[model samples]
Target: MPSLNPASRERVLVLLRHARAESWGETDHDRHLADEGRADAGAAGRWLAEQGLVPDHALVSSATRTQETWQSLAEAAGWSLEPQLDDGLYSAGPDTVLDLVRGTSSEARTLVVIGHNPTVAYLAQMLDDGDGDPTAAADMVMGYPTCALTVLTFDGDWSALDLASATVTAFHVGRA
Candidate 1:
């Protein structure tokens, strides 16, 4: 068991689903973020800003929708972060995504990962506080909606994070 006494171990990853997309596209993998999705990204960005939650690093999917969502929020915040196009994220499940984060630079604090769902929703629900507003992530128990965010905290080295150990913080959607 890892002790929760390392300040450097507090690496937070705020996982979010990109905003609503108008089209599902020809294939599920090819869908792009909709206009509403763009708006949702901005809205989420503003809300995050208000909460004073700024991620030090971001990992995004290569899908158009995911990229657009990531870019929109970055623009809204006037942040010029270099986001890597993780192909693994484009088709990974919650476990794979969690592993990806755990493999990141140990020095990086506060990471944000933007991808599609059921992974996002499942991951959130798995690491939730058990008391956040369901409306904030209403479908997480069933499914996650577009533009939803599930914030989690872990008091251990990112390399050692596990589904059973992370603490849920906020599963936010609408404005606070």
Candidate 2:
């Protein structure tokens, strides 16, 4: 956990959906990212660097595809942060995801979470306070494509995270 400043009001939560993965006839959890997925993951990382949003901590799903996505992103961004891989995030719902986020250490100001769809997309929709980029919000309504990254800002502690409590700062789909 990073050192916390009580006076710091802004916290960043970056929700990233795993990149496109191949079926490979393997179990859902065992599938890995496709070549395109790898490229997109790297692109996502580059975009994060361009935004100057470096995560102080990261929570990633245990699924193979998610892990691969994280690895690709890290390599591309030249980031070297050890992320916690949890099975609970594999098929978790939006509520569960929210709970996990709320449980994060307050010492961490920026947190990046990588997970599967539906849940990831659902979390973003539920948390946005409607004061963000209108175009991005509109694009999200259509769909949260593979490797999509949604950056959310909150002025409260992690324990206070809840539905509609964050302002959507940036929402980018696909590679930069």
Candidate 3:
């Protein structure tokens, strides 16, 4: 894994907000990503790949939009990864998402969560120690737009994760 600081043991987490989707009168769970959303998600994946942040594990929401977002990103990045779709992620709150994070396998050095907001957005802000890239932090503070990716670094194991336990290392707003 790429390390920002070699002296400190770090666990990386990438939170991705589902890309833009069209409701089209479907139920919230059935909403699918729009064309622009697919492109945006692809760009986000490419950005991660370029940064050498390939996820060892991905937790994705079972909702249609979230699934589409992950699929687009994985394909664009040419990743061989397969995400675990959980029903619990559908409209989950920060605490619930945190639990899912805490349960991550120890062997997986890099983890990603692709879901909805304001849970994903709120969690990023909550975990951030305000010690990373200022411009990236500012973009996150503004709000997590469609396909936005927030990269965080924690000093401990996943089971020890909690509010303010990590620092925002990088943030990217995927291109449309």
Candidate 4:
């Protein structure tokens, strides 16, 4: 983990939604992570673990691909953190997304959010700082390819964050 001030112990985090996924019809919300998406999730998870960015808690969309993504990520990173499955996140907008993040408990310093696009893409754009590798972040800005990740950071607990209080510090996706 990067050096965060003690004041930052009350963290506000927003994990980028995972990459591509099968359409809802094919797999429903519980069975959507494709083979490729699985690999991508692993890569993204490894990246997160390597950075010591593991979350104490996770907020996941109650969608198959999203759940599958987290499963693969947990497998790769050896993380056993508890995650809440949220039905509300399947097609929520950015404001709801912010609300989901803010819902994290005060004692939890880190949080991971897994969900669908448009909202995730928009959130990444809002939080990105251009400090991470440009080439790596290109997919995030251009499009969130399946299983991609946009890691972000903030100074306070989730509720304290506004639009400008965060920044995307890194982006990751499995190589094809």
For model 2, residues 1-176, the per-residue Cα lDDT tens digits are 12222236789999999999997846999999999999999999987876777788899999999999999998888889999999999989999999999999998888999998899999999999998877777777789999998888888889999899987777887563
Clashing pairs in 3: none
Against the unseen true structure, what C-alpha lDDT does each candidate score? 0.74, 0.87, 0.88, 0.72
Please write out the lDDT profile of model 3 over residues 1-176, one tens digit for every residue: 23533134577899999999996736889999999999999999898888777788999999999999999999888898999999999978999999999999877778889999899999999998877777888989898888998999887888999988787878888895
Model 2: pairs clashing at backbone N, Cα or C within 3 Å: none
Where does model 4 exceed 4 Å of error? 1-7, 10-14, 23-31, 128-139
Stretches of candidate 3 exceeding 4 Å from the true structure = 1-8
Work out the TM-score per prediction.
0.83, 0.93, 0.93, 0.83
Listed per candidate, the RMSD to the true structure in angstroms reads 4.6, 3.8, 2.2, 3.0
The digit string of per-residue lDDT tens for model 4 on 4-36 reads 222445463646566556655644665576677
In the range 77-135, model 1's lDDT, one tens digit per residue, is 66777887798898899999989888877777778899888888877776665554445
The local lDDT score (0 to 100) that residue 134 gets in candidate 3 is 78
Q: How does residue 150 of candidate 3 score in lDDT?
A: 91
Q: Which portions of model 1 miss their true places by more than 4 Å?
A: 1-8, 24-27, 129-143, 174-176
Question: What lDDT is reached at residue 23 by model 3?
Answer: 62
> Which runs in model 2 stand beyond 4 Å of their true positions?
1-7
As for candidate 4, its clashing pairs are: 19-146, 19-147, 20-146, 20-147, 29-64
Query: What is the alpha-carbon RMSD of candidate 2 to the true structure?
Result: 3.8
